[model samples]
Target chain A: MTKKERPDNRKLDEIRPMKMKAGVIKRADGSAQVEFGLTKVVAAVYGPRQIHPRHQEDATKSVLRCRYNMLPFSVSDRKRQGYDRRSTELAKVITEALEPALFLEEFPKTAIDVDMEIVQADAGTRAAAINAASLAIADAGIPMRDLVTSVAAGRANKELLLDMTKEEEDAEDAVDVPMAMMPRTGKITLLQMDGIVTPQDTEKIICLAEVGCKKIYEAQKKALLEKYGS
Target chain B: MDKEKTIESKTLSAEPAKIVVPGDILKESMDILPGTGTFRENKNIISKVLGIARTDGRVISVTPLSGVYIPQRRDYIIGEISGINFSNWSVDISGPYEANLPISEVNGYIERDADLSRYYAVGDIIFAKVNDISKTKYITLSMKDPKARKLTGGFITELTPSKVPRLIGKAGSMITLIKERTNSFISVGQNGRVWIKGEDDNVALQAIEMIEKYSHTQGLTDKISDMLDKALGKPKEKE
Candidate 1:
């Protein structure tokens, strides 16, 4: 079918350039920074210790609190920190995404909080945050079921693109699909989509995202090894 | 209706396909589009539909079919106070639940009927220990315990709970590195609250920021210590 294409002229399945670095933050228990083209996010991990208020303690398992935040300058518009509805929602989504991967039961009555800060936004801020947060957790030395890799794929101009850029996302009528997966067990932890696509098209996008997530997962592992050695 | 007819024609012409599993390597050769679904390895049609569930098409997200919950001890965390009682306080610990801290958990003593307000007022940020939990779901906390106490005087940095291990490093090596270098007393709460105190606020602040920067690194202890030595102009050896 004839359709207007993306500026990069990439094929339906091609992903953008991906770069990842771990140990970017010193004070956090674990940290990582990832960039998908222009999209950038930093993730840090803290916790698995004590629950301060005696009442909130869990007798059975540890808790995971996740916060997904975008810097004021991360987007075209400036954003504030703390308790905004968007950040709160993002935090809950991230917490749910990471819950399965973490060994919460290992630290009963405690909680772990993962914070993701988006330094720049092109497209796929949430996906980038998920990928970076997984790396940060590993960097923090938290045991996990596996590393989570995420990517955004979309049907732009009827063509599916892996890792959509800001321009492509803004210019096209596309369905954005973000997914997180465990590199080792090949399990899915989080998946999200927006806009519209035929069931057949959606299936294709998921397949492509999984493939992209694996590639991103490899990059995450490589970065971790490089920073930590072996 | 012409557009509908055209789309129907395209669907018929579209190649018969399958679903992609979690670990499947997606490549151009793969018939699935980047944002589309895939066939399972068993040839079952697996759609990586978006949002919370299959019915929510506008939203795209993947969720576990099912799973179990388990808790571990000694994990770091960040918690918020939800309620305060005469004997204890309640917190939302971000699990399937909330946590509690008894009055005895306060670092200092409270006269039998002393006002609780002087101690841990509502919304106070304290770092305590999770002593134990009853099967009935009672979570016990203690601040008098050496490991649990009031976290005071330090820059508070937040991170993902997953990365806490990397910050502490192998057997607490990472934190030790920062403490020795800056001569700052550091306490890492299980709930993601970190407390650092030192005579020199600048030194303490710098050390905390560095920790935030490198928490995820392996072998970061040495790298950071060396950086601190140079930045602070302190002798490599401790006095």
Candidate 2:
């Protein structure tokens, strides 16, 4: 059977090239950089330290604060320098995706702050950002129940792809499904759909994403262990 | 059949010391008890985060090799005074939570609002004990003991809190060697803060950097001693 070829010469089920590195920043308690195809993100973890504005402190669990930003020069056009609507929404979802994996109760009344800056952006920037942030948190030595891994799967031209790029994402009738998972338990932590997709396609997309996330999880684990010389 | 084989081929490498990430199932057995860095669910023992799987007497755990310091009870720590309120001083013990040294927790009776800044003004470094940690994450500190006092005339630096135990070494052997060779007084806090003083301060600091840099390397003790000897120019005396 002849496999349908994507513009990038990848198979329909193939994801783009990816890389993840931990402990990239000396000053941050923990930091990681991740690259998925053309998208690149650097995430730094700071604090378990004191939570300011005393009232915001949670007595039962550590608060997770995430800030997702894009550099002005990251894309074709110069992006704005501060938080925009898209960035805010991305930050909220990213935080929610990571919150469940942490053992926040271990560090009550403190906050684990994650700052993710996208230096490059394709269509799946959010997935790359979450991937980088999880590595940064682990690098920070924060206790977590598991590392969260993410990937974007989509359907284009009546075909399902494991990971979609900016071009594939912009195509009309394209369906993008970004999903994050805890690989060991195979639990989905984050799922969002853009564009219309059939229920069967959604199921296929989710399964493909889970498989892709498992691969990403291996990269994350390798980067973390490399930092410790293990 | 091909897809089924592919899924089966994705099984984790079970070799001991192999790195495991969160959600990776370490085992599936009720005989093994989950320990730190691990959790059990659905009859499977899985790692909660990044670490190496370790088993001792049917108890399984993952020992994290990196990350920040999470404060615990009875940990001796060094902290810098950040703020002073009516009754307690906020201390930065290098963790997520700031420790509070209540005036009452000090060795001497502090007069209420009687120029208490003289006792522990903002920016003073204190060697204290984790007296108690409330559920709200309020860390209460105590300086009533002899070693617990205001530290003065020392250079302070930091390391990953997880590496602090390695720096201290078995039975404090690493610290003892550093002290004897450098002839400097040093105090290591559980929060990853270290204070160094005396004539061999430079030598001591070099040794510490070596330890922090090669923390995961083997023969750390010998490496540290060699680094110290080179820095201090002290010939090794035969034991």
Candidate 3:
């Protein structure tokens, strides 16, 4: 198939435009807004503060809580209010992805709450949210081994696309993979796949996702330096 | 270069302080020790957050520009009573860690297991100092010092604890200016809470905001002084 046959009419390795800004929310200890093409997500980091439900507090490490939500108007069809099974699972994955990068032991008995709200979703919202959340956590001054950045890669028109968009995601026989990493250490933190693809394609997609995450990493660093004034 | 020469050249000298992000390599030397806001890995001291790198002798640490206040030794802080235990009272120090004020560290000795509620109840604010912090980050408070006591009848506001130094200024100049100009008794906690009392409470609060906004800028003391004069409607004296 020709390049014109690809969804979004772009090259196989071309990613969507990404923009990130840190310290956007006044009330939050740290906050950031991120945009990957048409997908928009805002993440706020609250606390290392008191953990409620008093029983849940951990004396050895800070409990990191992450909430991922999509605004009702975010999708083509309005998303329902409250969380569904998908969002609940996504939240757990995001929290797990961020936990490894933090020095949780330094903040024992505290909870760092990360709230990521997707105000618009085209596709790859989770990846965008991960980038935004990493920025927020850093902005909040929580110690971390490194920032976790992510991107979605998938097969479309028999080619692996760097950052999958809505149209490419809905294509027939698509194999979507969302991958996150601590860019500096090159450590994989989160990886999820949907649909079946050949071993070669899977390897190729993961490699593409790494390259994509590096780009997002630069954007995250740029945003942070801008807010903190270099 | 020999190891000693390299160490001698780097020791007691630091690059001008600049903001750094997570994973940024601060220094690569076994001779230099890593301090707060940094972690050591394979002779490389890497920053763990976005903050300013502060070097003292052979030790390099990072001070966060913004974030929760982590209690350190001998830091004067203000806390609110959250709960009372058998021998200790839990105080919220506005950070992730909760501080415990043991009865022994209170102003005077109180009988153990006696009705402690009468002494200090929940929601009562107190001024104290961090006595000890456990490995698990359990904070302990003490009020045996003369300045440490139960604070009352004042309003509290907060700033980013990192900016507290700016508010206090060099040798307490900024705070002294605020107190004298506003005629308000001000107590600043290292945890970022500020208590102000007097008829000029509004003026103090405004001056504080100005300090916070211009903390990083140069000539802030003069700027705050002009602001206070204008707010107080004082005419400029003819030079």
Q: For all candidates, state DockQ relative to the true structure.
A: 0.05, 0.57, 0.77
The positional error of residue A155 in candidate 2, measured at the CA in angstroms, is 1.6
Candidate 3 off by > 4 Å: A1-9, B1-16, B84-88, B108-121, B233-239
Tens digits of per-residue lDDT for model 2 on A1-230?
Answer: 12989989998878789888998998887899999889999999997777888799887888999999999999999997999999999999999999988889887787889999999998899999999999999877677778899999988877889889888877878999999988866889999998898788799889889889989888888888787676
DockQ computed for model 2 against the true two-chain complex using alpha carbons = 0.57
Interface RMSD of 3: 1.5
Count of steric clashes across candidates, in order: 99, 10, 0
**Global Cα RMSD, each model:** 16.4, 7.2, 5.1
Q: By TM-score, how accurate is candidate 3?
A: 0.88
Candidate 1: TM of chain A? 0.92
Off by over 4 Å in 2: B1-20, B56-58, B109-113, B234-239
Evaluated with lDDT, which candidate comes out highest? 3
The sequence of per-residue lDDT tens digits that candidate 1 reaches over residues A26-90 is 76767889988788999987765456676877767887878888888888877665568878887
Reference contacts preserved by each model: 0.03, 0.76, 0.91
Off by over 4 Å in 1: A1-5, A52-55, A80-83, B1-239
**Candidate 1 vs. truth: CA RMSD?**
16.4
**After TM-score superposition, what is the CA distance of residue A44 in candidate 3 from its true location, in Å?**
1.7
Give the per-residue lDDT digits (tens) of candidate 3, residues A93-153: 9998899999998878888999999999999999999999999999998999999999999
Question: How would you class the docking of model 3?
Answer: medium
- Please identify which of the two predictions, 1 or 2, would achieve the higher lDDT against the true structure: 2
